[model samples]
Each structure stands twice: as C-alpha cells, then as structure tokens.
Target: MARGFRLIFATSLLLMLLGICNGSTIGICYGRNADDLPTPEKAVELIKNLNINSVRIYDSNIQVLKAFANTGIELMIGIPNSDLLPFSQFQTNADTWLKNNILPYYPATKITYITVGAEVTEAPTNVSAMVVPAMTNVYTALRKAGLHRKIKVSTTHSLGVLSRSYPPSAGAFNSRHAGFLKPLLEFLAEKQSPFLVNTYPYYAYRDSSSNVSLDYALFESSSEVIDPNTGLLYTNMLDAQIDSIYFALMGLNFKTIKIMVTETGWPSKGSPKETAATPENAQTYNTNLIRHVINNTGTPAKPGEELDVYIFSLFNENRKPGLDSERNWGLYYPDQTSVYNIDFSGKGTVDVNTGGNLTTVNGTSWCIASPTASEKDLRNGLDWACGSGNVDCSPIQPSQPCFQPDSLVSHASYAFNSYYQQNGATDIACSFGGTGVNERFQPQVLIVYS
Candidate 1:
C-alpha cells in the first residue's frame, strides 16, 4: 500500500514538472536612457530577430508598446521611481495608468508583469516606504482589470537591501529595510510572484579588486566559498549572491517565495575607480552566466531548481548618471551590436543545404526575440554589422577575413562567438555553405564592408 501511494505521488509530481518545463520563459531588461537609439519599431524587430520573447522596460512608453504589438514578446513594464508617490496616494492613479499605458496595449503587446517600483527600497532616497504600497495599488489595479493571473506584480531590489551577506547562511536584510521588506515578501508569496534582484559581482570586485579573485567574480574556476551554516561550497559568485537573497527571505519567514535575478551583468569598461570593469572580464562573467542558466543548475541551497534570470541593459545608456560602470552594463551598443562574446545553449545555429526560409535556419531564429536574439550566433551576426569583432571567424575563413579593428561591429561579432563558448553552446557547428549562405549578410555600417 505504501509503495502504491509513493508511485501515485511520483506521477502527480511528474505532471507538474512537465508543465513547468513546457512553459518556462526567459526575459531581458530594456532600460532606455540613451539619447541616440533605434526607434521602438526597429528595436522590436531587433529583439524579434534575436528570438528574445520577454522584455522589462523601465517605463510604459506607448511607442514601445505599439512596436511590440503582435510580436508575442512578454513585457514587464514599470512605474518609475518618481511615480511611486502619486501612485501610493491614489488607487485611481494606478487604475488610470492601466487604462492609459497597459489596457490599451494588452493581449496585443503581451504584457505579463508590471513592476510597481524598481529598486526603490534599495534607493538612497526617502521613497523607500512608498514602494510596497505602490506595489499593492498596482496589484489591485491589475486585479480590477482581471489581469492579476496573467500579469504578476512586484518590485526589484538591489543588493543594498542586504545587511549581512557573507558566509551565505548568515544573509539577512538591513534591519531598517525589514519593516517594509517583510510585508512586501508576504505580499509576493501570497500573490505567487518572484522576488526580483539586481546583482552585480562587478560592483563587488570594483570596490576591492585586490582582495577578490577576478576569476571567482567572473564565474570561472575558483576555490569554493562555503556557507558556514550549511557547509555547502559555491564555485561561482552568482550562486553565492543568489543564496544570500534566499537566506534573507528565509529570515523573513518567506522561504517558499521564489527569488529571481531580474538583472545581473558585468560592465565592459570603466574609469580608474572602476578599473576591474573591462571587456574581457565582462565576457567571462556573462558567458559563464548564460551557461549556468541553460544548465538550470541551482545554488547550494536549492540544487535542482531552475533560477529565472534577466540580464541587465540590452544597450549601454551613455546618458545615465553615476560612475562609468553605470553606462557600461549593456550587452550590446545602441545600434544593437554586441559588447562582448558569449554563447547561449538552445540559441545556436546549424546550417542545412536545403532551400528554406532564412528565418527558420536552426540558429538564425532568435529564440528570445522581440528585442534581443537569444542565440549567440545571430547576436554575433548583429554585432558583426556594427564592427564589434568579438566573433573570431579566423577558423571559418579560407584566409584571414579583413575585420575592421576599430569598427564596433567587428567587436560585436567577436563578442557573440566568445559569448557562445562562455555560455553553453558546446555542440554548435558553423556552416560555411548553405542555400542562403551568400545572402546571409552580417550588418555592414559601411566602415567595414565599404
């Protein structure tokens, strides 16, 4: 009888597992603070071409929503820091926002999440207290519109929320933040939403590069950092950073609530103070990160569970304030070119000689499109246009392909291939000849091709 019961339980669990596997989604943050950039329509085409299915914009720009229409990209739009005050005071404001910025674009644009305030609690300003209430109001508005189930509500937090994060097990929120954080966590758990976090190991390294192992922070081979309480070893800084959040959640008694890395990335360049921020290190960190995501490997605390992640900005925002690193977190430049090389599994390509649509080529289809292509090769193709020669086509070329050294497109191409190897595109093979081989043109901004 016990054996029969065990088998029944296993079957039920199997069905649940299948459901998650079939519907899991990956997203990217689309922070648009740059002055010179592509229009929303072109941006949508870029993302669609890359196969990125999800995006999180910092605000509800109508142009962006209109661009995403019928593209099937799952959007997560936000209420900016300045709007939180008015939103907290009036539920009507929330409702109006929905009617104005959301409802009009729904189903057609496919908005799946609405962040009330991104990293407000972690901000140095006094708006911290308004965050939770604003989120509540936003959730209420969504429920009123019958979008609660389709669109979850939450706010992103910075690592500044943590008071103690060393030894992993001892992670806890700053006592000052707990007043609002505790209740917010409760709301998230009840609503079945994830706790979003923006983590940057580059920040940690930049603060004190001498003490930190560059390889460790870059997600490369290193001595494991063990959690004092659990005695579990972590080989990568990302897992360690994530587990810190889990520990904090556990301390608040909301252990069951899922934690998502809404934003995590490395900068490609920086000033003297942020010297650790370099192109090579950025590639290493991101490459390892994508592989970690594909492998679905969890932290020491949750070994098998897949962690949801969204990389930082799609393009560098040159106009953003703060240190040099702030503008350098972009994976690509303003023109949709790559900043470094990294490969992502399930986003690579294979060449076939059979005549077929160019869009369906194994790796050509952007798995994460509507904004950024999910596969490394296609992303490399985009970068190749801008002359970011991060893609090393040396092996594939019959002779040395004349890459424009100063061209951003060349750098992007190299970065894409580098990203693939760093991520998990271990089995991908490049095709030299195919039906559309001649037509498969990389982006040529004239400097390289002309």
Candidate 2:
C-alpha cells in the first residue's frame, strides 16, 4: 500500500513539473510558528509532492537543514533579529554561526541565500542598525569559507521603508531610515546581491478598502492608475510597490542592484472586520499572482525583466500573534492539505490528482469514507467538511432521502462526497485527514443506493 501511494505521489509531482516547463519558478516561505506542523522530513516530502523547488525558512533549524540535505530544494536560511547585535559586534560570531549552521550542509542542501534579518526596519532602532553590519560580517565569513560566490547575503525590508510610494517615480526612502539604508544599499550594490522586500497589498487595502479597489489589490484591475510623473499605467498595487523600491534605489544611484520580493500573499481567512480575506479571494490572488510573475512581463517600469518572488508562507500558523489574518495566509492547513485548489503552473487550472495511472478523470465521481481509515479521523473530517468547509449537509440529514442507512460511515460518505464535488474535484479536495477516497460512480448507481 505504501509503495502504491509513493508511486502515485511521484507521478503527480512529475505531471505538475511538466506543466510548469520554461515558466518562471516560484518559491514558498516555510514559517514554523505553528505547533501542529509535520516533522521536517515529512514537510520536505510534502513540498516535493507539490512540485515546489524552492523554500525560505525563518531560521536554520538543524533538523530542517538535515531533512533538506539530498532533497535538491534551493533554500534561503535566515539569521533572526535577536542575533543581529552579536553578529554585528564580532566577526567571530558570524564565522561560528556559519561553521555550525551552514558549512556542514552547503552544496548538499543547495543553500543559495542567507538573509541577515527579516524586516529589520520594523525592529528597534538599535537592532535595525545592526542589519547592514551583520550582513557584512556574514558575507566576510562566507568569503573566508570559500562559499561567497555560491551564497548571496542580504536582509529583508518591509514596504514601510519608503516614505513616498505613490507615483512610483517619485518614491524615496524615509529620512529617518536614510542613515541605515544608505550604507546598506551601497553594500548590496557593491556585493551585487539582490534587495529583498516584503510587499503586501492586503495591508494597503485593509487600511483603506474604500480608497483601494479590491480588483487592484487582487491583480484583476481593469482600470489603471497612471503615475502623473512618469505616465506609467499601473494595473496592480504589487507592481507599484515593486517599482517604488526601484525608484528609491535609483535615488541613491544604485540603479544596477536587483530587487526580489521575499514575501507576499493573501489570507484564506480573517476576522469579521477583514472583509476581503476569504478563501475565494486568496485563490484568486495567488492564481493570478502566479500567472503574472511567470509571464515575466515585469512591471510597467521594468518590462520583460525576470523577478524572483516567494509567497509568504506554506501553512496557516495557529500560534502566530496578530490579527486573525496573520495566521491565515498559508496555502495549506497543518495536515498539508490545500486550503483551496490552485495551479502553480502558469498554465490554466488543473486538478490535483494522486491516483497512479489515473492522471485525469472525466466521468462523475464521489468521495467516500475510506474503509481503512480510523473512526476518529473520519468523524473529525466529517465535522470539518460540514462545518467550516460550508458544504451543504442537508442531503445527509436524519429525515433526508439519503440518510436511510443511519450510520456514521454512510452519512460521512455523503457529506464528504458533496464537499469534494463542490470543491475542485481534485485529490486534495477528497483528502479529509486521509479518511476520504474518490470512486467513480454513475448518477443511476447513487439513485439505486438511495
């Protein structure tokens, strides 16, 4: 059984990879703020199964680093904000960190980048001050270890660094942050490393939904916002955000430095006040985002340029502190199940199938409880399918025509199949904690059973 499952998983991954051919590669941020996440080894397997070739972790956990070994997935490891002070104060600290956290893995793990700090500008002034020096020290350590050429070093900045963002051509760094940003930009330009920035259109729209159109935030805007200064027509907020960084760099005469979006995504759920945060909206945002980035049709300011982007996260973090939206940006649930179906390939929507030799199914099918699954798991999955999933369970009610069997398995099978069909009819849609299975069935067959 395990061997069959592995074969199906491998074939599905291969099909996904084929669909992404020659398109822009996308990366995911793997944040581990939730306690329910799977082990690193399992997590790596899930990532591969999804055909994601790149990942960025907040820190270099040894278990995760070991799991990544031999996986051939490109990684961007990070140095947390708390470590910046010590790393900047002493080169020895940086060298020691490298020797312990990075040297042992190296080429085997495919570590391509090391972020010195994440959104350092959002930290205290002193911690923010350490960002550039820490990056310099880390770069020096990599050079001494003969790994400088292989690994690029930099820090991630928030969009807050820009004092003026509208009319992207006029974008400039906030004066208060200039003292730190000036030298940081110089080092990045000199080292030829890319500037990493986290840009979220969700926040912009959340703060002023009345002013910002939902279509603009989700990359579906038909009306354009023309920048008066440069006359560039902006269709989406993300592009404007990216170009603002470019103008800021140009202001400092660092025209040649490249920019990479380190983090960006929409939440699948949110508090009542967060009206725009919904699973459908997240699906639209991410699907459109993949198409936009992979098209390699860069922003209006930088057309036809290849830009690297990493989605904000992989799993919803239950323990993350902030608004409900903070914990809901993940594309997957803790069980590695997709929150909604999405095609990472630039191609059109494709169903996620995990059945060997059955890549595509045309006939009607129904999701039913797997005979081998545990009772507890089935019940839990049934509750979720009927509750949060918003699947209508009316057909399986006690007095309903389909409720004659009056068994947990029977009712659950009906509910599960209903939810699955309402979703994308994909393998993930039927994966209710491994308790559901897809089976081909005719309407007459179900009618006879009824």
Expressed as tens digits, the lDDT of each residue in 373-418 for candidate 2 is 8889989988998788755454455543345455677667766765
Off by over 4 Å in 1: 1-25, 346-450
249-347 in candidate 1: lDDT tens per residue?
877767557777889888888878676788898888877787666544556775534477888868899899988888988878888888886554433
Candidate closest to the true structure, highest lDDT: 2
Candidate 1 local distance difference test against the native: 0.67
TM-score, one value per model: 0.72, 0.72
Question: What stretches of model 2 exceed 4 Å from their correct place?
Answer: 1-24, 348-450
Residue pair clashes in candidate 2: none
